[model samples]
Target: MKKEIGSEFWTVEQTAEKQHLFNAFKRNQRFFLSGRTALDFLIKNIKAKKPIRKAYLPSYCCHSMIQPFLDNDIEVIFYEVLIKENKLMIKVDPNVECDLFYTIQYFGFVDEQLDDFIRKIKQQGKLIVEDATHSLFTAKAFHTEADYVFASLRKWTGLPGGALVWSNETLYAPASKTDSNKAYIEKREAAYRLKRRYIEGEPIEKKAFLTLFDEAEQMLDKDYRGYGCGQEIQEQIEHLDIAKIKKNRQENAAFLCEKLRFCKDIELLYKAVKQDTCPVFVPIIVKKHQRDPLRAFLIQQNIYCPIHWPISPMHKLNVGTEALYKNTLSLVCDQRYEIEDMTSIVNAIIQFFERK
Candidate 1:
C-alpha cells in the first residue's frame, strides 16, 4: 500500500496497542483510563504529581501531538526551533509560570543540549517528555531518563496509537476502566480496507485519497484550543517490523540525499545525523512558489508528491505566518519508493524549477 507514514498514521498489523490507535479512532471507549490523551497521561506522570500547569513546545510540529494537555486545561509554552545545531531553544510563557518544559529532537538528533535541558528542568522538579513521533527510531524514546516520553507509533513504527512511557515509577496514571475497544477495532479495519483498496486500485477518486486512509480517523486534540494545534489521529500504530523497516527507511533517506544533492530546487531536508541509521521520511524546502504547479505536474505523471505540514510554527502563535509554507514541502521518500521513483521525483523537481 502507498504509505502515508509521513502524517503519523500507519498499519497496525502487529499488536493491540497499534490497533487501538488505528481502529479506535476518536470514540476512545477502550481505556477510558484516568487520563484521556497521551499528554494527560504525561502530565499525571509529572514529578509534581499535581496538575501539570505548563510545558514547552516545538514552534514547528504536529499540533495534535500536544493537544491532550490543552484539552485538559494544561499550560503549553512555545519554543522556537533553534538553528543552533540540535540544541533546543526556548522562551517562557508570560503569566503562565510553568515549571515543566518539554522539547522535541526534531529530525531525531538527540543532541547534548536536549539532555542538558531535561536535566536542568528535572533539577527544578519539573518534567520533560521527548516528543519522538518524528524522530522515534533515530533518537531512542527511552534513551534518557526524561520524566515521561511518547512516540507517534505510526510515524516510525507505523502503529496507530500514541501515548506516554514513563521512566520514574513514582509518576501517577490511573488505569483505564473502559472495556471492549470496538471503535478502535472498527477504525483499524477501515484503515486496512482502505489500504487494500488503494493497493488493488479499488477506484479511489484521486491518488491523494491514499494518504487520507490513515489520517481520516484522527481525533481533534483539544490542547490547542488556545491556538489550534489540531486533533490526534489515534489510528492503529502497530506491527513494527523493527529491523527491516528501519533498514529500509535509512537506506531510502541516504539514497535520496546522495542522488538529489545537486537538485537545484530541492533544498537539503534534515541533517542525516543518526549514528545507527534507518530513516524514512525526507522533507525539503522548495525554492519557489511552484509548490502547486510542481505538485500538479508530478501527480499527472502518476508520481505522488505531497507537502508535510499545514502551518509553520512562526504562524502558530500569531507570531509570523508569512513564512508559513515558503518552500517547506514533505515528499514521500520511504521504503516503498525505489531508486527510479527517487530519480523521477528529483528530475521532475529540478526540471520544473530549472525551466524557471
Candidate 2:
C-alpha cells in the first residue's frame, strides 16, 4: 500500500513518557487557540503599553501574519525579501520609522543577518516581534533582541488548537476565552482521529476527514479572535516528545538535501541542514511554468507538496518577490516521515524530471 506524504497531521497515541519543550521561554508565556490568535493578542498587548502607529513586515508573508496588525489599526509597511544564492535575504531600511518590526525564521534556517538587523532597530527603541512558527524546533528559535515571540504549535504537531505567545516583559490576558473556539477545536480533533484511522488502512473515505479539516479551517479564517487555547490541547503539548520530533525532522531534511542537491528541474532553498536547524519543509524553487505541473505529477505519485503561499495582490510585491512566490513549493520533511519515505519522494521527483 502506498503512503501519503504530506497534508494535515493524523492523530497519534501520546507517549507515556512525556517531556517539557518550552521550559526556557515559559516565563510570561500565554497559550492561544491558534498562532493568528496569539499574534492578535500580542499586538493588542503591545499597543496597550505603547502607541504603535505602524509595523514593518516581510513582503513575503502569509496574509494571516499581516492581518493581526491590520485588525489592531496599525499600518503595515512591508520590507523586501529576495532569494539570493538559494537563501532568503531580508531588506529592511534602517532609516524608516516604525513602532514594531516583525521577523520570520523561514524553513528553520537561522539568518544571522536578520539578528543584526533586529539589534540595530532595537537600539532605535522599536519593539521586535519574531514569528518562530517555522523555526520553533530550531536551536536558535528565539531572538535575543525580540521583545515578543510567537509560534503556531499545530504546525509542528498533531494538536486540536494551540499557539504560544510570550514576551520578555509581562504579558496581558487574552481578550477572548477558548469557549468561543470550542466548535473549531472539536472539528479539528475529530478530523485528526479520523485521519489516523484512514492512514492505518481502515476502510474510510479520504473526504471524511478532509471535510472536517476544511470546516475547521473555515471557522478559523472567519473568526480568529483573541481566543485562548483549550486546556486539553495545552496538556497534549506538555506530553510531546519534542526532542525526538526535532531530531527526526532534522535527519529527514538532511537526507533529502543530500539526495536532491543537484536536481535539474528544482533548486533547494537550503543546501544543507545545519546542526541547529530543524526544518519543517525542504523547500524547492521550480520554473514558473513547470511548478504546478511538477506538483501535480508528485501528487499522482502519492506525494502531496504545498506551495509556501500564493502572494496576495494587496501587498503589491516587487518583481523578484512575485517570481519567488510563483515558483516556490514546499516538500515534506516533517517528523511524520522517515528516511525511507523521503527516499520514495526523492525517487518520484527524479522520475518526474527525467520524463522531461
Candidate 3:
C-alpha cells in the first residue's frame, strides 16, 4: 500500500499519554489557541509587571516568534548564529544586554554552548524566555531558569489547537476551566474525522481529511491571546506517550542521518542528539539550486516536507536571514512514523538526486 507521511497524528490513547507527560514537566501550564497566542499573552503579562524595552532574538527565527514583541512595541535586536559541525552556536554580545533574551533549542540540539548562553543571560539578570517548541520531547523539557517558557504543542503532536506556557514557579493561575466554544467544537469534529480515517481504515478521500484538518488549524489562527484551550483538546493532550514519542523521533532522525549522509546535494543541519535533545524533524540545507525541486519531488511521492519558514518581507531584507530561510527544509520524522516510513523517505530522496 502507498503511504502518506505528514504531520504528527494521534489517537485518543496517544493524546492521553501526552497529558501525563505534560503534567511531569510542571504542575501548572496554560494552554492557548496557538503558540503565538500563548506568547502574546505571556509578553503582555510580563510587560505589565516589568518595563521590557528590548528583546534579543536569533537572526534566523520564525516570523510568528517576532510578532508578539513587535506588536507590543518592544525593540528587536538580532544576533548572529553560527552553524558548525552540525551544531548551532549562538553569538550574542554578553555586554549588550536587553530586557529579555530569547533562545531556541534549535531542532532539539542544545549543546553546552547554548546551556552556557542561557546561564549567562540569567546571570545578567535578564528575563529569559526559552522557546521549547522544537524540543518538547526532551527529558529536561521545562528545565529552564527563564522567567517564562512557551511551546507550540501542535508542532510535535496531533492535536489541532493548543499551545502551552509554563513557568518554574506559580507566577499566576491558569484558566481554571476549559470552555465549549465554537473553535473547540470545530477542532473536535475535524480531529475525530481525521483520526477515524487515519487509524480505523475508514474510506475517506485524502482531501477530505486535509480539509477538515485545515479547518481545524484555521480556528486556532485567530488572535485569541489570554484564552485557554478547550477541555476536549486538553483531554487529547493527556494521552500522548512522551517517552515513546522521544524514542521514535530520536531513532528515526538518526536513521535519516545515517541513510542520507552521503547526499552531496544536501547538508544535515543537525546530526547528533545529546541527552536533553529530542528532535521534532530532520532539517537539511538543500543546495540552493536544488532546494525547490527537491521539495517538489518529495511532495510528488506523498512525502510532504516544509521549509522551516519563508522569510517575511522585513526579514527578507537581511542577507543572512533570507539565505537561511531559502535553504532550510524540514522533513517530518516525528513519532508517528516507523523505520519503514523513514526507509521509504530515504529511498525517495536518494532517487530524486540520482535522477537529477
Candidate 4:
C-alpha cells in the first residue's frame, strides 16, 4: 500500500549536521512552547509599555491569533479579505481607529496589497505585529518592519513544541517562567515516534498515534500560559537542513500549481509560486457544497488536508468572508513530500471530481 500523503509530521532522526537554525536570525529572539504563547508574550510586553485599546486583524485568521489580544482587554476589529480572479485583496478603511494592527502572510504567499496597507497604517503610528506561522520558510518572514514577529515551528517541522518571537529591537523578558506541560509534550513526542515507525513499515496501528496527537492537542487547548522551548526541541532545530527544506517546498508547490491548473470544480488560490515563497500549503477553493465531501474523499485515499480555519461564532463575519472560509481547503505541499507524492495528491483530487 502507498504511504499516507499528509498529516502530522514525524519526528526527525538525529543527523550529523549542526546548522544552527537560530543563528540565521539577526534580531533578538526567544523560544516558546507554541505560536500562541509567543504572541501572548509579545502582547503583554506591548501592554506594559502602552495602553492598547483596539487592534485591527484580518478576518481570515485562526482563533488562537485573536485570543491573546482579547485576553489583554484589547478590542479586535476585523477587516475584510476578499478573493477576485484568484488573487487575495485586503479591504480596510484608513480612517478606522485602531491602536495596533496585525497582519499575516497567508499560505507563505506575500500579498503586496496587504503590505501597502500595513505601511499606510504604520505611518499613522499603529503598532504592528506579524504572524509568520505560515511564512516562516519564506524570505519575507523576518524582513518586516513590524514591532513584533512570531512563528510556530511545529507547523513546519516535527517538533513537539516550538515557536519563536523576535524583534529588531530588544524584547522585554517574559514575565512568567516558561510553561512545563510535560504531559502534552510527551504525548506529542510519542505520537511522532509511532508515526515514524508506522511509516517505516512497523506493525503499529494508526489509531495509536492519532489518539496521542488528539490528546496532546486537547491539553494544549486547555493551557493558555506561555512556555519556553525545551532543550531537546532546540537541539533538533539545530540539525535541520533549512535550505533543503525550502527548496523542496518550492518545487512541490510549483508542481502542484501546474498539475492542478485544469482541475474541474477547483480553483487554485495561487496561480504561480513566487521566487521567494516556500509554500506551507497549496490552498484551493472548492464549491461550497463539495468542500467537505472532497475533504472526506481525500482522507479515504490516505491524503489528509486541513481547513485554513473554522472561525468562531463570536466574530460575526460578512457573507463573502463566510463563503471564503467554508469553501477553502489547505492542501499539503510541505517539505515532507516530493514530486511523486504531489502527483499522487493531484491524481487523487482529480479522481474525486471525476466521480461527481
Which regions of candidate 2 deviate over 4 angstroms? 178-180
TM-score: model 4 vs. ground truth: 0.94
RMSD of 4: 1.8
User: Can you give the lDDT of residue 130 in candidate 3?
Assistant: 79
lDDT of 2 by residue, 5-69 (tens): 99999854356665667887755788898889999989888877889999999998898898888
Measured by lDDT, the strongest candidate is 2
Backbone clashes under 3 angstroms, per model: 26, 0, 15, 0
C-alpha RMSD of each candidate structure in angstroms: 7.1, 1.6, 3.0, 1.8
- Residue 68, candidate 4: how far off, in angstroms? 1.3
Scored by TM-score, the top model is 2
Q: CA shift at 80, candidate 3, in angstroms?
A: 2.7
Give one digit per residue, the lDDT tens place, for model 4 in 1-356: 33888889995534578976655667788888888888888888788888899999989899888888887888999999866665566787766899988889899987777767777888898888989888888877744678888899888878898888888766787537655467889999999999888999999899999999999988987885666778788777777778877888999999999999888688998888988998899999886469899999999988999997887864658987777788888989877778999998899889988887
Ranking by lDDT: 2, 4, 3, 1
lDDT of each candidate versus the true structure = 0.50, 0.85, 0.73, 0.83
When summed lDDT is taken over every stretch of 10 residues in candidate 4, the lowest stretch is: 173-182
Q: Which ten residues in a row have the lowest lDDT in candidate 3?
A: 10-19
**lDDT of each residue in 1-356, candidate 3, tens digit only:** 33678643644336322345566665456777678777887787787688999998888788888878888899888887655443455677866869998878777765456677777778889888878888777766644587788888778766666788887645454543345246654765676566566655666676676676667656644544456777777766766667778888888888888888888878888765555578888888777468788889989888888787767753423554456676778888877789899998999888998896
Whichever of 2 and 4 has more lDDT, that candidate is 2
